[model samples]
Target: MKKKWVHIIIISVVFLYLFLPLAATFLYSIAKEWHNTILPVSYTFSAYENLYTDPRFLQAVGRTLLISGITLVLSVVTMATATFVVFMYLPKMERVLQALVMIPFAVPGVVAAVGLIKVYSSGPIILSGTIWILIGAYYVLVLPYMYQGIRNNLRTIDAKRLMEAAEVLGASKIKGFAFVIMPNMVTGILLSALLSFSILIGEFVLANFLIGGYYETIQVYLMRRLNENGHLASSIVITYFLTVAAISWMMLRLGRRFGKTEEIKEKIS
Candidate 1:
């Protein structure tokens, strides 16, 4: 009874913590005088009504999705290939390279942001404020997460045996990799993409410094509106929440796919 009560309390607190701001955002989005009050003097849908007609919010959504899609593809392919190389062929150098891959994680996001700014200050390819720079910085910030996730998935499979069997069965190296090895690693690749997608949407450190207000992601856009005391900002917050929830749903689906694969088997004639 005590343990059950503790669990209930913990869950309740977590729900409150997670949902209170969302609740407040909703309340303020429809409120007239939410300023300096325990409750609103009145409620209205005027905030959301105004937000739908705004172009900046719509543009922020488009830019956020555009950058996230690019980052997702790059991160998934890069990390999945790295996992295949390290686990299948370069076992000797895996530890050293793994350590190197984590250097970005050790460096603060602010430092990376600053370095990227100076590095791109002037070049044949000036990327400081471009969407590409944000994508690249996002890749660096979250590469470790991808590496760890895909590497774990590779560890779970009999990568060496599977690759060798496929190779010996008239499967050329590339085809074997593409069809045989890749099918097994699909879950890992999806998970890595999901993580990269999540980080890209909300990662403000690099977006704020490297790109600044010139091209803002949702977080930066909402933050800019936050200072102005407008109800449109509340709608932005809810959009951000829904975006995160979608990524979470994708990650859970990946987990279920991997888990179910173990229980199902194939027959050999």
Candidate 2:
């Protein structure tokens, strides 16, 4: 009983530590003035109102989503294909492939940005200062998450047996992958995509360095306006947190639903 109470106290303290800042930010976002007070002098939605009223803010939101979506799609398709090929055709090279995929984690963002700029600034394909550069950078940034998530999930199933079974039933390699392997991997793919989207949406270093003014993402917009308005910044952070939380919750629901469906299918089979 004493140990359980100690654990409860520790958990409570951690939750309070994590939540207090968010609570304060939410209050500040609505507070008309919080000067030298424990709470706001008054409350209003003007910060959010003003935030939405600005056309640039809307543009930033759209741009952020566009980048995130593009990165998510690119990472998912590429990693999925790569993992499938390595596991199906080139099992012996899995370690090499994993090392290659993990190269991004070893490289610092600043170094990568500089290398990209130096390479693409005056090349045949000038991607520095373009949305393409941001997309490419984001794709690399999220590769590890997508690869590991899908690869680990794939390992849980007997992928070789599944593919062979599909082949024995007279399915082509393409059909086997599309129909058999793909469906089983949907939950993992979706989870990875959500995680990638969240990471890309919150990314700032590459955005600010690679395509700052040419294409303004939410993070870029936030950085630019961070000093101008405290309430507006707080509102942006709150909105971002809410959006990420929603995606996370959706991922959880998907994992549970998929797990149950697979369990039922196993019993039926």
Candidate 3:
């Protein structure tokens, strides 16, 4: 039918729009020289090899992972505890907390970075150029995702009933949370952490403005090297995309396994 043809055309357009740039980047990453041609005349993996072997690039990657990991852990713990408390004992304050979390999204990154610099540059806590500032900024940036993901999952699993049941069986509140609620929230927590990690790893605006020379992340490194070699920059972009995709794929697999285990437990019960 004409409708079916239209649907196929639309789908093809969408796919091309999404992946054409990625295809070009991948091609450029491997191309020895690409000019005045539809495709490169020659290809090589030297760009990738060079990117991987570079000490500075490796150091930037390590630093990025370190900061992103710490930020995820800190954000997860803080958001989880706060979300639990707000949902359980202080449900009335949920609106206030939600509004607070939306602040990061409302404010521009540059404005936030400037605000942080002004507040921390000369205060008793001088954290403007430190990794600690990045951690704090990342924590705020990820708060909404972390809170929403865990809260939705907790609600989906009826965490309140689980907690109450555990407590009814003579377990203390902490014990109930540790043994009952935490297990159910593992998938949601991992999902949020992975999402936040992806965001933080690619973050450049705040990182560049706040702690550019003092601390460099993968994004900063990429920016610095972009002018040096187009092929190398393309390689970095391709590698970055692949790394994020791999981490996301692995986390999704783990999340599905946790979901299956939880479902089996429910069926057994």
Best by TM-score: 2
User: Which structure is stronger by lDDT: 2 or 3?
Assistant: 3
Query: Cα-based RMSD of the predictions, in order?
Result: 3.1, 2.1, 2.5
lDDT of 1 by residue, 1-269 (tens): 99999999999999999889889888877888766888899988877766666788778878888887888778787777877788888899788868977888788989888888888879787887788888888777777888887877766666677789998898987898888888888887778778777877778877888777888677677788876655777776776787799889988988888666544422221
Off by over 4 Å in 3: 248-269
Q: What lDDT does model 3 reach? A: 0.89
| lDDT scores of the candidates, listed in order | 0.79, 0.86, 0.89
Taking the tens digit of each residue's C-alpha lDDT, what string does model 3 give over 1-269?
99999999999999999999999999999999788999999999999999999999899989989999898988888899999989989999999999998988999999999999999999699998999998889889988889888888777677888899999999999999999999888888988888888888878998998898788888899999988988998998899889889888977896787677668657856
Model 3 lowest lDDT segment of ten: 260-269
**Count of residue pairs whose backbone atoms collide, per candidate:** 1, 0, 0
- Lowest summed lDDT window (length 10), candidate 2: 260-269
Q: In model 3, what lDDT does residue 127 have?
A: 94
Off by more than 4 A, model 1: 32-43, 123-125, 262-269
